[model samples]
Target: MNEIIQLNILQFSLIYLLLILVLILMKKSKISQSKLLLLGTFRMSLQLVLAGFILTAIFENPHPLFTIAYVAAMVIFSITRILRKNPWLNSSFRWSVSLSLTLTGLFILGYFTQIVIGVSLFNPQYTIPLAGMIIGNAMTGITLALKTFHESLTSGRNRMETLLNLGASPKQILLPDVNRALETALLPTMNSMLGMGIIALPGMMTGQILSGTSPSTAILYQIAIMVAITAAVCLAVFCSLHFGYRSLYNQRNQLNLPR
Candidate 1:
């Protein structure tokens, strides 16, 4: 295959033209969030540019500590985002989320890099990108689960109160919500898996192909990464909900959720 064609700065700038189409559609539709969209786009571009520089330096150096530190930062940032999105939380709930994400994110990252991919845990080339994908998905999964869990409890509070008064155990009353949250958390990953390849080439696969990787090789890596992402999302969400729901009650099994 010929070497991958590189896009010059001018050529890359042309891609921004698509944004004008988006702006026009938003204006026509009278969308109030156009400013938010523009702000998000700007932030995304700036953050990615910064990340590109950092990643370039890290890749050139290739140290274990750099990769480890990067992974730690990812987990910390993920937890921070989750917490920021959810301001109303108790100590137990906070601890649960923090521990669940940290433990599961690290655990899955190790397993995927060392076991699945047979790469060193500190190999920045593999670990850094893979960690970003795994940890980001875990963060997303937990966030969705938390949102669904809260909404479910909020909507079903009356039924929950009746069940509690009727002597139902906290676990019994909360199991459905926990299950619902897990389902909601896993739906996006599951749906993506269902439509992959046939419906659309996922980002990773498309990037690999564009970089001149053989189709078979790209396909294999894409499949492996998708499986890893799904596993990480499942384990992280499961652990977060399993331990997190308990934080909603005390030792006496009395419900104590945020108002």
Candidate 2:
């Protein structure tokens, strides 16, 4: 393998400057996301620096157990972050979302590595990054799904109650909002998959090419990763909405309007 190239402080500072300018412009436009932008930049820089050191250590050792532990930590952290962002959500709902994402992400990641990629001993090079991508995508999907479902149920309480009064089952009453929420949650993944190689060269594919992998090999990995992401997103969103419904109704099955 070739030595990794280092980014100079000058280059990093330039990117930060651009981010600040963009955030300022967004604030001027009444976007109200200045804090979010600042937080995101800080978190991104810190996480990447920590991950870089961790990856260096793992690459030196390259043990299968360490690789698995790293991936598991990523999944757990991602799920916890999602839940933390929605503090109004019940604990059970949070657990369901986390369980759903972890199960689906692990299943797809395991299958892709063992069955498709055919890597021996689940190397860190493949497992860690792939698991990161899967967990990240699943996190976004679950967050969107939960937010959308919560908003819809709260806003459409009357409609949902009317449907239930008309003899619709809990499933039937919530079907429309559930489907809409799931679709919205999965939209980003769907758009990226559809627009891959056209609107943007995906980051993974671009990195692979820059690392001197053949275009064909990079494309294969890109396609496989995209498929895995889509599957994980869909499953995560579905499971989130499925389990989230329980929090929307009470013992008498009445819709619980947010106070």
Candidate 3:
């Protein structure tokens, strides 16, 4: 077993103080001139502590059912966050995001685990963290795509209406906006993957190397993760846009703008 290096109270306090100093600098730069710094830090610390304890308990027991349950909880929590972030979205949009994220994330994760790696029993150590990363990224992509689509539809309602009146179908009128939104959602992932090793070391790859994995092995994992993220993001964004279009049009296929 790797020796667990513990941070003394004084060290932990100094680390937190450094974080606060960084936040203060950020505020001074007008990056975020709100009390959100303190609140966000507090929430982050609390959540991390709670998650640490819960993960510790799960790691000790390490049952398959428990692992599966935790993964499901992560997906559900992520979906709920997506819905909360896009409160204006209808139920169908929410369900589509949930379904897309779960299906895409699970498919990528399952392929990586069962076919690529082929680990026996699907250990929680690998599955949970990997699934969390993929699902989290997918959630972000879906949310961004949906938000962009909704904003574009609402803002371009007049243009869309004109197009519809000119005999354009809903899909035709919306495809340009939907495609743009999906591209916007995908740009960050694409850029990160493209510039990964050249620009900066990714967190996962760095952590893997720090934890004593070989560079080759870490690179392989990083590649797999990047591919999975791309696939999941594309799937989630496409699904969100496809389902979100329904909410923007009425029974007669006319664009509905909220007055």
Candidate 4:
């Protein structure tokens, strides 16, 4: 590897030109998402630049507290993002999502950092990146799960009530919806896994290879991280749905879905 070719400011600015293609297509199609596209691009650039500086500092001076704080911040942000994405959920459902994401995210993060990766649990270099990937995927998975669950339940509200009137347990009535949501949540990760080497070069593997890591070693890390991401997604989605559906009812086992 030849010292990791550096991208100068001018060179880096050229990447933004690619967005022009998207803008042209949107304009031709009369899509009104140009503003969102620009805003997303600007925010992504700013956030990644800030993260780069912060990560540099942390990498230079690694500390357990720093890593833990970063992880906690990520969890908080993930919860906030999920709630913002799902404003229609009840307070009880919000609690369920927050708890499920926090618990499952941290649990898997610990396991991956300490056991699977065999790195120091508090090593910022490894833990921060890995936690971002793990928590980020879990957040996306749970968001999709909640969306699917809400849609399915809302559409099938009459059927749910019929089941309840027929003496069906809450579990019995909600199991199908739960399973559907879980499957929806896992599908993206599963599809990506299926197309790993054939259709795409995933971000992690590409980053590692560019940084001069051997292709074989990068492949191993990529595989491990994908598996970890899928596991985290499953656990987070399952926990959210498992506890979330119960929130639809009270002590009397009566359904109280939001109107």
Off by over 4 Å in 1: none
Error of 2 at 34 (Å): 5.7
TM-score for predicted model 2 compared with the true structure? 0.86
- Residues 105-193 of candidate 2: C-alpha lDDT, one tens digit per residue: 88888888899999853699988999989889999988888788778877887887788888777777887888999999889998887
Task: State model 1's lDDT.
Answer: 0.88
TM-score of each: 0.97, 0.86, 0.90, 0.97
Candidate 2 yields a Cα-based lDDT of: 0.84
Query: Between prediction 1 and prediction 2, which has the larger lDDT?
Result: 1
Q: Write the per-residue lDDT of candidate 1 for residues 135-227, one digit (tens) a residue.
A: 899899999999998888888899998999999999999988999899999999999999999999989888888989998998998888888
How big is the positional error of residue 211 in model 3, measured in Å on the Cα after superposition? 2.1
Model 2 stretches with alpha carbons more than 4 Å out: 1-39, 250-259
Global lDDT of model 4: 0.91
Q: How close to the true structure is residue 225 of candidate 2, measured as C-alpha lDDT? A: 95
TM-score of 3: 0.90
Model 3 lDDT per residue over 83-154, tens place: 888887766666777787887788888887888789643578888888888899998898888777778878
Cα shift from native, residue 78, model 4 (Å): 0.7
What C-alpha lDDT values do all the predictions have?
0.88, 0.84, 0.83, 0.91
Query: Using lDDT as the measure, which candidate wins?
Result: 4
